[model samples]
Target: MTYTPPAPAIVDDIVSKTKFDANGLISAIAQDTKGVILMLAWMNADALRETLLTGRVCYWSRSRQSLWRKGETSGQQQHLIEARLDCDMDAVLMIVDQTGVACHTGRRSCFYHGVTPDGLRDTAQPEISTKELYGH
Candidate 1:
Protein backbone atom coordinates (compact mmCIF):
# COMPACT_ATOMS: atom_id res chain seq x y z
CA MET A 1 0.00 0.00 0.00
CA THR A 2 1.22 3.46 -0.85
CA TYR A 3 1.79 5.92 1.97
CA THR A 4 -0.43 8.89 2.58
CA PRO A 5 1.03 12.19 3.61
CA PRO A 6 0.77 13.06 7.25
CA ALA A 7 -1.00 16.20 8.34
CA PRO A 8 0.96 19.42 8.12
CA ALA A 9 1.09 19.58 11.88
CA ILE A 10 2.47 16.10 12.04
CA VAL A 11 5.01 16.92 9.40
CA ASP A 12 6.07 19.95 11.30
CA ASP A 13 6.37 17.91 14.43
CA ILE A 14 8.53 15.33 12.73
CA VAL A 15 10.76 17.86 11.07
CA SER A 16 11.21 19.65 14.31
CA LYS A 17 11.96 16.51 16.31
CA THR A 18 14.48 15.09 13.90
CA LYS A 19 18.13 15.63 14.63
CA PHE A 20 20.27 16.13 11.57
CA ASP A 21 23.99 15.66 11.74
CA ALA A 22 26.51 18.38 11.17
CA ASN A 23 26.16 17.65 7.47
CA GLY A 24 22.45 18.30 7.77
CA LEU A 25 21.68 14.73 6.91
CA ILE A 26 20.25 11.59 8.48
CA SER A 27 20.62 7.95 7.63
CA ALA A 28 17.63 6.36 5.93
CA ILE A 29 17.22 2.62 5.70
CA ALA A 30 14.78 1.28 3.13
CA GLN A 31 13.08 -2.03 3.67
CA ASP A 32 10.38 -3.98 1.91
CA THR A 33 6.94 -4.39 3.40
CA LYS A 34 7.87 -7.96 4.32
CA GLY A 35 10.65 -6.55 6.50
CA VAL A 36 13.46 -7.34 4.13
CA ILE A 37 16.10 -4.67 4.23
CA LEU A 38 16.71 -3.10 0.84
CA MET A 39 19.28 -0.37 1.04
CA LEU A 40 20.53 2.55 3.05
CA ALA A 41 20.90 6.14 1.92
CA TRP A 42 21.17 9.61 3.34
CA MET A 43 18.42 12.21 3.41
CA ASN A 44 18.46 15.87 4.07
CA ALA A 45 15.47 17.80 5.32
CA ASP A 46 14.36 18.56 1.78
CA ALA A 47 14.64 14.96 0.76
CA LEU A 48 12.67 13.85 3.78
CA ARG A 49 9.99 16.41 3.01
CA GLU A 50 9.81 15.34 -0.60
CA THR A 51 9.46 11.68 0.33
CA LEU A 52 6.69 12.43 2.80
CA LEU A 53 4.85 14.72 0.44
CA THR A 54 5.17 12.58 -2.67
CA GLY A 55 5.21 9.00 -1.27
CA ARG A 56 8.26 8.35 -3.38
CA VAL A 57 11.69 7.56 -1.99
CA CYS A 58 14.03 10.52 -2.40
CA TYR A 59 17.56 10.86 -1.03
CA TRP A 60 20.42 13.27 -0.70
CA SER A 61 23.33 12.33 -2.89
CA ARG A 62 26.52 13.43 -1.21
CA SER A 63 28.49 12.75 -4.33
CA ARG A 64 26.12 14.74 -6.51
CA GLN A 65 25.29 17.31 -3.85
CA SER A 66 21.66 17.18 -4.96
CA LEU A 67 18.40 15.35 -4.57
CA TRP A 68 18.32 11.85 -5.96
CA ARG A 69 14.88 10.57 -6.67
CA LYS A 70 14.83 6.82 -6.81
CA GLY A 71 13.88 5.37 -10.19
CA GLU A 72 14.13 8.73 -11.89
CA THR A 73 16.68 7.46 -14.38
CA SER A 74 16.32 3.73 -13.94
CA GLY A 75 12.81 2.24 -13.79
CA GLN A 76 13.38 0.95 -10.24
CA GLN A 77 11.21 3.20 -8.15
CA GLN A 78 10.50 2.75 -4.45
CA HIS A 79 6.97 3.58 -3.38
CA LEU A 80 6.78 4.43 0.29
CA ILE A 81 4.63 2.15 2.42
CA GLU A 82 5.57 3.67 5.76
CA ALA A 83 8.20 5.87 7.34
CA ARG A 84 9.44 5.67 10.89
CA LEU A 85 11.85 7.80 12.81
CA ASP A 86 14.23 6.08 15.19
CA CYS A 87 13.76 6.53 18.89
CA ASP A 88 16.71 8.87 18.96
CA MET A 89 15.20 10.81 16.06
CA ASP A 90 18.48 10.71 14.23
CA ALA A 91 17.60 8.20 11.54
CA VAL A 92 14.65 7.06 9.46
CA LEU A 93 13.35 3.68 8.41
CA MET A 94 11.40 3.54 5.19
CA ILE A 95 9.23 0.62 4.22
CA VAL A 96 8.48 0.54 0.53
CA ASP A 97 7.13 -1.32 -2.44
CA GLN A 98 10.14 -1.67 -4.61
CA THR A 99 9.81 -1.90 -8.38
CA GLY A 100 12.54 -3.70 -10.26
CA VAL A 101 15.82 -3.77 -8.32
CA ALA A 102 17.00 -1.71 -5.38
CA CYS A 103 20.72 -2.08 -5.81
CA HIS A 104 22.52 0.06 -8.36
CA THR A 105 24.24 -3.09 -9.53
CA GLY A 106 20.80 -4.48 -10.47
CA ARG A 107 20.55 -6.76 -7.47
CA ARG A 108 17.42 -7.05 -5.35
CA SER A 109 19.31 -5.35 -2.50
CA CYS A 110 22.56 -3.52 -1.95
CA PHE A 111 23.60 -5.97 0.76
CA TYR A 112 24.73 -8.73 -1.54
CA HIS A 113 28.08 -9.16 0.09
CA GLY A 114 28.56 -11.28 3.20
CA VAL A 115 31.63 -11.18 5.39
CA THR A 116 32.72 -14.50 6.76
CA PRO A 117 35.75 -15.66 8.68
CA ASP A 118 37.19 -16.63 5.33
CA GLY A 119 36.62 -13.26 3.75
CA LEU A 120 34.06 -11.12 1.97
CA ARG A 121 31.87 -13.18 -0.34
CA ASP A 122 29.22 -12.34 -2.87
CA THR A 123 25.90 -13.68 -1.60
CA ALA A 124 23.64 -12.65 -4.42
CA GLN A 125 24.15 -12.15 -8.13
CA PRO A 126 22.87 -9.22 -10.10
CA GLU A 127 19.57 -9.82 -11.82
CA ILE A 128 20.23 -7.21 -14.48
CA SER A 129 23.40 -5.75 -15.78
CA THR A 130 24.37 -2.34 -14.42
CA LYS A 131 25.40 -1.37 -17.92
CA GLU A 132 21.87 -2.01 -19.05
CA LEU A 133 20.28 -0.44 -16.02
CA TYR A 134 22.26 2.78 -16.46
CA GLY A 135 22.55 2.45 -20.21
CA HIS A 136 26.28 2.73 -19.92
Candidate 2:
Protein backbone atom coordinates (compact mmCIF):
# COMPACT_ATOMS: atom_id res chain seq x y z
CA MET A 1 0.00 0.00 0.00
CA THR A 2 1.23 3.48 -0.80
CA TYR A 3 1.17 6.13 1.89
CA THR A 4 1.59 9.82 1.41
CA PRO A 5 3.62 11.82 3.87
CA PRO A 6 1.73 13.97 6.31
CA ALA A 7 1.75 17.76 6.18
CA PRO A 8 4.83 19.66 7.31
CA ALA A 9 2.98 21.12 10.29
CA ILE A 10 2.04 17.66 11.56
CA VAL A 11 5.54 16.36 11.02
CA ASP A 12 7.01 19.28 12.91
CA ASP A 13 4.72 18.64 15.85
CA ILE A 14 5.61 14.97 16.05
CA VAL A 15 9.35 15.54 15.86
CA SER A 16 9.20 18.35 18.34
CA LYS A 17 7.34 16.23 20.88
CA THR A 18 9.65 13.24 20.77
CA LYS A 19 12.68 12.98 23.06
CA PHE A 20 15.33 10.77 21.52
CA ASP A 21 17.96 9.16 23.73
CA ALA A 22 21.64 10.07 23.87
CA ASN A 23 22.21 8.00 20.75
CA GLY A 24 19.32 9.82 19.12
CA LEU A 25 17.27 6.64 19.25
CA ILE A 26 14.02 5.43 20.79
CA SER A 27 12.86 1.90 21.48
CA ALA A 28 9.96 0.98 19.20
CA ILE A 29 7.78 -1.91 20.24
CA ALA A 30 5.94 -3.55 17.36
CA GLN A 31 2.70 -5.31 18.16
CA ASP A 32 0.29 -7.16 15.92
CA THR A 33 -3.35 -6.28 15.39
CA LYS A 34 -4.27 -9.01 17.87
CA GLY A 35 -2.16 -7.18 20.53
CA VAL A 36 0.69 -9.64 20.60
CA ILE A 37 4.13 -8.10 20.82
CA LEU A 38 6.17 -9.11 17.81
CA MET A 39 9.53 -7.39 18.13
CA LEU A 40 11.58 -4.68 19.71
CA ALA A 41 13.75 -2.41 17.62
CA TRP A 42 15.51 0.91 17.77
CA MET A 43 14.49 3.97 15.79
CA ASN A 44 16.37 7.18 15.27
CA ALA A 45 14.77 10.49 14.43
CA ASP A 46 15.12 9.81 10.74
CA ALA A 47 13.69 6.35 11.11
CA LEU A 48 10.73 7.67 13.01
CA ARG A 49 10.18 10.35 10.44
CA GLU A 50 10.28 7.85 7.62
CA THR A 51 7.97 5.44 9.39
CA LEU A 52 5.50 8.17 10.07
CA LEU A 53 5.79 9.46 6.57
CA THR A 54 5.50 6.15 4.76
CA GLY A 55 3.37 4.09 7.17
CA ARG A 56 5.98 1.37 7.10
CA VAL A 57 7.96 0.14 10.09
CA CYS A 58 11.54 1.43 9.96
CA TYR A 59 14.35 1.01 12.46
CA TRP A 60 17.88 2.10 13.12
CA SER A 61 20.23 -0.82 12.63
CA ARG A 62 22.77 -0.49 15.43
CA SER A 63 24.96 -3.24 14.01
CA ARG A 64 24.74 -2.02 10.42
CA GLN A 65 24.74 1.66 11.42
CA SER A 66 21.96 2.46 8.99
CA LEU A 67 18.23 2.58 8.48
CA TRP A 68 16.56 -0.83 8.23
CA ARG A 69 13.11 -1.12 6.77
CA LYS A 70 11.46 -4.25 8.07
CA GLY A 71 10.71 -6.92 5.47
CA GLU A 72 12.61 -5.04 2.79
CA THR A 73 14.44 -8.21 1.83
CA SER A 74 12.26 -10.89 3.31
CA GLY A 75 8.50 -10.56 2.56
CA GLN A 76 7.52 -9.99 6.20
CA GLN A 77 6.59 -6.36 5.89
CA GLN A 78 4.96 -4.57 8.80
CA HIS A 79 2.37 -2.02 7.84
CA LEU A 80 1.95 0.59 10.55
CA ILE A 81 -1.59 1.03 11.84
CA GLU A 82 -0.74 3.51 14.53
CA ALA A 83 2.28 4.98 16.32
CA ARG A 84 2.12 5.86 19.99
CA LEU A 85 4.67 7.63 22.16
CA ASP A 86 5.32 7.06 25.81
CA CYS A 87 4.54 9.71 28.38
CA ASP A 88 8.10 10.96 28.42
CA MET A 89 8.27 10.51 24.65
CA ASP A 90 11.35 8.33 25.10
CA ALA A 91 9.81 5.25 23.55
CA VAL A 92 7.29 4.36 20.86
CA LEU A 93 4.67 1.67 20.47
CA MET A 94 3.64 0.73 16.95
CA ILE A 95 0.46 -1.14 16.14
CA VAL A 96 1.05 -2.97 12.91
CA ASP A 97 -0.45 -5.35 10.41
CA GLN A 98 2.33 -7.88 10.10
CA THR A 99 2.71 -10.02 7.01
CA GLY A 100 4.25 -13.47 7.44
CA VAL A 101 6.62 -13.76 10.44
CA ALA A 102 8.11 -10.91 12.42
CA CYS A 103 11.36 -12.57 13.49
CA HIS A 104 14.41 -12.98 11.30
CA THR A 105 14.52 -16.56 12.55
CA GLY A 106 11.17 -17.19 10.84
CA ARG A 107 9.18 -17.07 14.06
CA ARG A 108 5.94 -15.19 14.54
CA SER A 109 7.56 -13.04 17.18
CA CYS A 110 11.14 -12.14 18.08
CA PHE A 111 10.27 -12.95 21.70
CA TYR A 112 10.03 -16.71 21.55
CA HIS A 113 12.08 -17.38 24.66
CA GLY A 114 10.98 -17.85 28.24
CA VAL A 115 12.69 -17.93 31.59
CA THR A 116 12.23 -21.42 32.99
CA PRO A 117 13.86 -23.74 35.52
CA ASP A 118 16.05 -24.91 32.66
CA GLY A 119 17.04 -21.29 32.14
CA LEU A 120 16.07 -19.69 28.86
CA ARG A 121 13.90 -22.01 26.82
CA ASP A 122 12.10 -21.82 23.53
CA THR A 123 8.50 -20.98 24.20
CA ALA A 124 7.42 -21.37 20.60
CA GLN A 125 8.55 -22.95 17.38
CA PRO A 126 9.13 -21.21 14.08
CA GLU A 127 6.20 -21.36 11.70
CA ILE A 128 8.52 -21.16 8.71
CA SER A 129 12.15 -22.08 8.28
CA THR A 130 14.66 -19.25 8.24
CA LYS A 131 16.12 -20.57 5.01
CA GLU A 132 12.68 -20.41 3.45
CA LEU A 133 12.13 -16.89 4.69
CA TYR A 134 15.51 -15.53 3.61
CA GLY A 135 16.06 -17.88 0.70
CA HIS A 136 19.50 -18.71 2.03
Candidate 3:
Protein backbone atom coordinates (compact mmCIF):
# COMPACT_ATOMS: atom_id res chain seq x y z
CA MET A 1 0.00 0.00 0.00
CA THR A 2 1.18 3.52 -0.75
CA TYR A 3 1.74 5.43 2.47
CA THR A 4 1.53 9.17 2.54
CA PRO A 5 3.64 10.98 5.10
CA PRO A 6 2.33 13.54 7.49
CA ALA A 7 2.67 17.23 6.74
CA PRO A 8 6.20 18.60 6.82
CA ALA A 9 5.39 20.77 9.80
CA ILE A 10 4.22 17.83 11.87
CA VAL A 11 7.28 15.85 10.98
CA ASP A 12 9.47 18.76 11.96
CA ASP A 13 7.78 19.11 15.31
CA ILE A 14 8.21 15.44 16.15
CA VAL A 15 11.82 15.36 15.06
CA SER A 16 12.67 18.44 17.05
CA LYS A 17 11.41 16.82 20.24
CA THR A 18 13.56 13.72 19.98
CA LYS A 19 16.70 13.84 22.12
CA PHE A 20 19.47 12.22 20.20
CA ASP A 21 22.61 11.40 22.14
CA ALA A 22 25.97 13.01 21.75
CA ASN A 23 26.59 10.62 18.90
CA GLY A 24 23.42 11.94 17.27
CA LEU A 25 21.64 8.65 17.76
CA ILE A 26 18.63 7.37 19.64
CA SER A 27 17.40 3.89 20.48
CA ALA A 28 14.57 2.63 18.31
CA ILE A 29 12.49 -0.40 19.12
CA ALA A 30 10.21 -2.12 16.65
CA GLN A 31 7.24 -4.05 17.94
CA ASP A 32 4.48 -5.91 16.17
CA THR A 33 0.81 -5.06 16.46
CA LYS A 34 0.49 -8.01 18.86
CA GLY A 35 2.97 -6.24 21.16
CA VAL A 36 5.80 -8.64 20.44
CA ILE A 37 9.13 -6.88 20.44
CA LEU A 38 10.81 -7.53 17.13
CA MET A 39 14.13 -5.74 17.19
CA LEU A 40 16.12 -2.88 18.61
CA ALA A 41 18.17 -0.57 16.49
CA TRP A 42 19.56 2.93 16.44
CA MET A 43 18.45 5.95 14.50
CA ASN A 44 19.78 9.33 13.70
CA ALA A 45 17.53 12.24 12.87
CA ASP A 46 17.75 11.47 9.18
CA ALA A 47 16.78 7.87 9.68
CA LEU A 48 13.84 8.80 11.87
CA ARG A 49 12.73 11.48 9.45
CA GLU A 50 12.93 9.14 6.49
CA THR A 51 10.98 6.46 8.32
CA LEU A 52 8.26 8.94 9.15
CA LEU A 53 8.21 10.33 5.65
CA THR A 54 8.15 6.96 3.91
CA GLY A 55 6.18 4.86 6.37
CA ARG A 56 8.92 2.27 6.34
CA VAL A 57 11.33 1.54 9.17
CA CYS A 58 14.82 2.94 8.87
CA TYR A 59 17.79 2.88 11.28
CA TRP A 60 21.22 4.29 11.72
CA SER A 61 23.97 1.75 11.16
CA ARG A 62 26.75 2.58 13.58
CA SER A 63 29.05 -0.01 12.08
CA ARG A 64 28.46 1.13 8.55
CA GLN A 65 28.08 4.76 9.47
CA SER A 66 25.02 5.16 7.26
CA LEU A 67 21.30 4.95 7.14
CA TRP A 68 20.00 1.40 7.06
CA ARG A 69 16.60 0.69 5.61
CA LYS A 70 15.27 -2.43 7.28
CA GLY A 71 14.86 -5.37 4.91
CA GLU A 72 16.51 -3.56 2.04
CA THR A 73 18.51 -6.69 1.30
CA SER A 74 16.76 -9.42 3.28
CA GLY A 75 13.17 -8.92 2.06
CA GLN A 76 12.03 -8.51 5.67
CA GLN A 77 10.51 -5.06 5.40
CA GLN A 78 8.80 -3.43 8.38
CA HIS A 79 5.80 -1.26 7.54
CA LEU A 80 5.24 1.39 10.15
CA ILE A 81 1.94 1.21 11.98
CA GLU A 82 2.76 3.93 14.48
CA ALA A 83 5.68 5.79 16.02
CA ARG A 84 5.92 6.94 19.61
CA LEU A 85 8.51 8.54 21.85
CA ASP A 86 9.47 7.82 25.42
CA CYS A 87 8.82 10.26 28.24
CA ASP A 88 12.35 11.57 27.97
CA MET A 89 12.26 11.50 24.16
CA ASP A 90 15.49 9.54 24.08
CA ALA A 91 13.91 6.47 22.59
CA VAL A 92 11.38 5.69 19.89
CA LEU A 93 8.91 2.85 19.75
CA MET A 94 7.79 1.84 16.31
CA ILE A 95 4.71 -0.29 15.84
CA VAL A 96 5.23 -2.18 12.63
CA ASP A 97 3.84 -4.92 10.44
CA GLN A 98 6.82 -7.11 9.83
CA THR A 99 7.19 -9.08 6.61
CA GLY A 100 9.65 -11.76 7.68
CA VAL A 101 12.44 -12.57 10.12
CA ALA A 102 13.50 -9.45 12.00
CA CYS A 103 16.87 -10.71 13.04
CA HIS A 104 19.79 -11.22 10.68
CA THR A 105 20.22 -14.58 12.37
CA GLY A 106 16.88 -15.44 10.76
CA ARG A 107 15.04 -15.40 14.09
CA ARG A 108 11.67 -13.70 14.44
CA SER A 109 13.09 -11.27 16.97
CA CYS A 110 16.54 -10.00 17.79
CA PHE A 111 16.04 -10.83 21.44
CA TYR A 112 16.36 -14.57 21.25
CA HIS A 113 18.98 -15.18 23.85
CA GLY A 114 17.68 -15.65 27.34
CA VAL A 115 19.41 -15.83 30.67
CA THR A 116 18.38 -19.03 32.35
CA PRO A 117 19.42 -21.17 35.27
CA ASP A 118 21.53 -23.08 32.81
CA GLY A 119 23.26 -19.96 31.61
CA LEU A 120 22.37 -18.06 28.43
CA ARG A 121 20.38 -20.07 25.94
CA ASP A 122 18.58 -19.51 22.71
CA THR A 123 14.89 -19.18 23.32
CA ALA A 124 13.94 -19.37 19.67
CA GLN A 125 15.14 -20.92 16.48
CA PRO A 126 15.64 -19.34 13.11
CA GLU A 127 12.60 -19.51 10.86
CA ILE A 128 14.75 -19.11 7.78
CA SER A 129 18.34 -19.85 7.03
CA THR A 130 20.74 -16.95 6.75
CA LYS A 131 21.46 -18.02 3.20
CA GLU A 132 17.77 -17.92 2.37
CA LEU A 133 17.28 -14.50 3.92
CA TYR A 134 20.30 -12.76 2.42
CA GLY A 135 21.23 -14.90 -0.59
CA HIS A 136 24.68 -15.23 0.85
Candidate 4:
Protein backbone atom coordinates (compact mmCIF):
# COMPACT_ATOMS: atom_id res chain seq x y z
CA MET A 1 0.00 0.00 0.00
CA THR A 2 1.20 3.47 -0.85
CA TYR A 3 1.66 5.52 2.29
CA THR A 4 0.44 9.02 1.84
CA PRO A 5 1.60 11.26 4.64
CA PRO A 6 -1.14 11.93 7.13
CA ALA A 7 -2.22 15.45 7.92
CA PRO A 8 -5.20 17.11 9.50
CA ALA A 9 -7.72 16.45 6.79
CA ILE A 10 -10.63 18.84 6.65
CA VAL A 11 -12.95 16.24 8.17
CA ASP A 12 -10.41 15.45 10.86
CA ASP A 13 -11.38 18.58 12.74
CA ILE A 14 -14.88 17.24 13.21
CA VAL A 15 -13.75 13.74 13.99
CA SER A 16 -13.00 12.74 17.53
CA LYS A 17 -9.70 10.96 17.82
CA THR A 18 -9.56 7.60 19.51
CA LYS A 19 -8.92 7.48 23.23
CA PHE A 20 -6.34 5.28 24.92
CA ASP A 21 -9.08 3.15 26.45
CA ALA A 22 -8.28 1.05 29.50
CA ASN A 23 -4.81 0.10 28.23
CA GLY A 24 -2.29 2.84 27.68
CA LEU A 25 -0.74 1.03 24.75
CA ILE A 26 -0.60 2.26 21.18
CA SER A 27 1.42 0.81 18.35
CA ALA A 28 4.11 2.90 16.70
CA ILE A 29 6.13 2.21 13.58
CA ALA A 30 9.34 3.90 12.49
CA GLN A 31 9.77 4.28 8.77
CA ASP A 32 12.28 5.83 6.48
CA THR A 33 11.55 8.33 3.75
CA LYS A 34 11.98 5.52 1.27
CA GLY A 35 9.16 3.74 3.06
CA VAL A 36 11.34 1.22 4.76
CA ILE A 37 10.20 0.17 8.20
CA LEU A 38 12.87 0.44 10.86
CA MET A 39 11.27 -0.53 14.11
CA LEU A 40 8.05 -0.81 16.07
CA ALA A 41 7.29 0.41 19.56
CA TRP A 42 4.48 1.20 21.93
CA MET A 43 3.44 4.61 23.16
CA ASN A 44 1.04 6.04 25.64
CA ALA A 45 -0.42 9.50 25.13
CA ASP A 46 2.34 10.95 27.28
CA ALA A 47 4.93 9.37 25.06
CA LEU A 48 3.14 10.73 22.03
CA ARG A 49 3.05 14.19 23.57
CA GLU A 50 6.69 13.97 24.52
CA THR A 51 7.62 12.87 21.00
CA LEU A 52 5.85 15.88 19.58
CA LEU A 53 7.27 18.31 22.11
CA THR A 54 10.84 17.01 22.05
CA GLY A 55 11.06 15.87 18.40
CA ARG A 56 12.42 12.61 19.71
CA VAL A 57 10.75 9.23 19.63
CA CYS A 58 9.46 8.24 23.05
CA TYR A 59 7.98 4.81 23.71
CA TRP A 60 6.24 3.11 26.60
CA SER A 61 8.25 -0.01 27.23
CA ARG A 62 6.23 -2.91 28.59
CA SER A 63 9.42 -4.59 29.75
CA ARG A 64 11.03 -1.53 31.28
CA GLN A 65 7.71 -0.26 32.63
CA SER A 66 8.69 3.30 31.75
CA LEU A 67 9.28 5.59 28.85
CA TRP A 68 12.11 4.47 26.65
CA ARG A 69 13.71 7.40 24.89
CA LYS A 70 14.88 6.24 21.50
CA GLY A 71 18.63 6.37 21.25
CA GLU A 72 18.96 7.73 24.79
CA THR A 73 21.97 5.55 25.46
CA SER A 74 22.85 4.24 21.98
CA GLY A 75 23.05 7.61 20.23
CA GLN A 76 21.03 6.12 17.38
CA GLN A 77 18.39 8.73 17.99
CA GLN A 78 15.37 9.08 15.78
CA HIS A 79 14.72 12.71 15.07
CA LEU A 80 11.01 12.93 14.48
CA ILE A 81 10.57 14.38 11.02
CA GLU A 82 6.91 13.47 10.87
CA ALA A 83 4.21 11.61 12.75
CA ARG A 84 1.10 9.92 11.37
CA LEU A 85 -1.83 8.06 12.79
CA ASP A 86 -3.46 5.10 11.14
CA CYS A 87 -7.01 5.43 9.88
CA ASP A 88 -8.25 3.74 13.04
CA MET A 89 -6.07 5.98 15.20
CA ASP A 90 -4.86 2.96 17.09
CA ALA A 91 -1.38 3.02 15.59
CA VAL A 92 1.28 5.59 14.76
CA LEU A 93 3.99 5.86 12.17
CA MET A 94 7.04 8.06 12.51
CA ILE A 95 9.24 9.38 9.77
CA VAL A 96 12.63 10.22 11.15
CA ASP A 97 16.15 11.33 10.43
CA GLN A 98 17.72 8.31 12.01
CA THR A 99 21.33 8.35 13.16
CA GLY A 100 23.79 5.51 13.72
CA VAL A 101 22.03 2.26 14.56
CA ALA A 102 18.44 2.01 15.78
CA CYS A 103 18.59 -1.48 17.18
CA HIS A 104 19.97 -2.71 20.51
CA THR A 105 21.55 -5.60 18.66
CA GLY A 106 23.99 -3.15 17.02
CA ARG A 107 22.21 -3.02 13.68
CA ARG A 108 21.28 0.05 11.69
CA SER A 109 17.65 -0.96 12.18
CA CYS A 110 15.77 -3.48 14.25
CA PHE A 111 15.00 -5.24 11.00
CA TYR A 112 18.64 -5.90 10.31
CA HIS A 113 18.56 -9.59 11.10
CA GLY A 114 16.15 -11.44 8.91
CA VAL A 115 15.07 -14.96 8.09
CA THR A 116 17.28 -16.75 5.64
CA PRO A 117 17.69 -20.21 4.21
CA ASP A 118 20.24 -20.83 6.94
CA GLY A 119 17.83 -19.81 9.64
CA LEU A 120 18.85 -16.55 11.34
CA ARG A 121 22.01 -14.57 10.86
CA ASP A 122 23.48 -11.25 11.83
CA THR A 123 23.05 -9.58 8.46
CA ALA A 124 24.15 -6.21 9.80
CA GLN A 125 26.00 -4.68 12.71
CA PRO A 126 26.19 -1.12 13.93
CA GLU A 127 29.17 1.01 13.00
CA ILE A 128 29.82 1.25 16.73
CA SER A 129 28.97 -1.13 19.52
CA THR A 130 26.45 -0.45 22.30
CA LYS A 131 29.06 -1.27 24.88
CA GLU A 132 31.28 1.31 23.25
CA LEU A 133 28.65 3.90 23.99
CA TYR A 134 27.78 2.82 27.53
CA GLY A 135 31.06 1.16 28.48
CA HIS A 136 30.71 -2.55 29.20
Give all TM-scores, in the order shown: 0.96, 0.93, 0.95, 0.78
Worst 10 residues of 3 by lDDT: 1-10
Instruction: Report, for every candidate in turn, its global Cα lDDT versus the true structure.
Output: 0.93, 0.90, 0.93, 0.74
lDDT of 1 by residue, 1-136 (tens): 7588988777777888899999999999999988889999999998998898889999999999999999999889999999999999999999999998999998999998999999999999999999978888
Estimate the lDDT of model 2: 0.90
Per-residue lDDT of model 2, residues 1-136, tens digit only: 3445688679768977899989999999999989999999999988998899889889999999999999988989998888889999999999899999999988999999999988999988999998888898
Overlapping backbone residue pairs in candidate 2 total 0
Runs of candidate 3 with Cα error greater than 4 angstroms are: 1-4
What is candidate 4's lDDT per residue for 23-110, written digit by digit as tens?
Answer: 8778889987778788988888778777766677889998989999987876778888887788878888888878866677676678
Candidate 1 TM-score, true structure as reference: 0.96
- Where does the lowest 10-residue lDDT sum fall in candidate 2? 1-10
Error of 2 at 41 (Å): 0.3
Task: Return the top candidate by lDDT.
Answer: 3
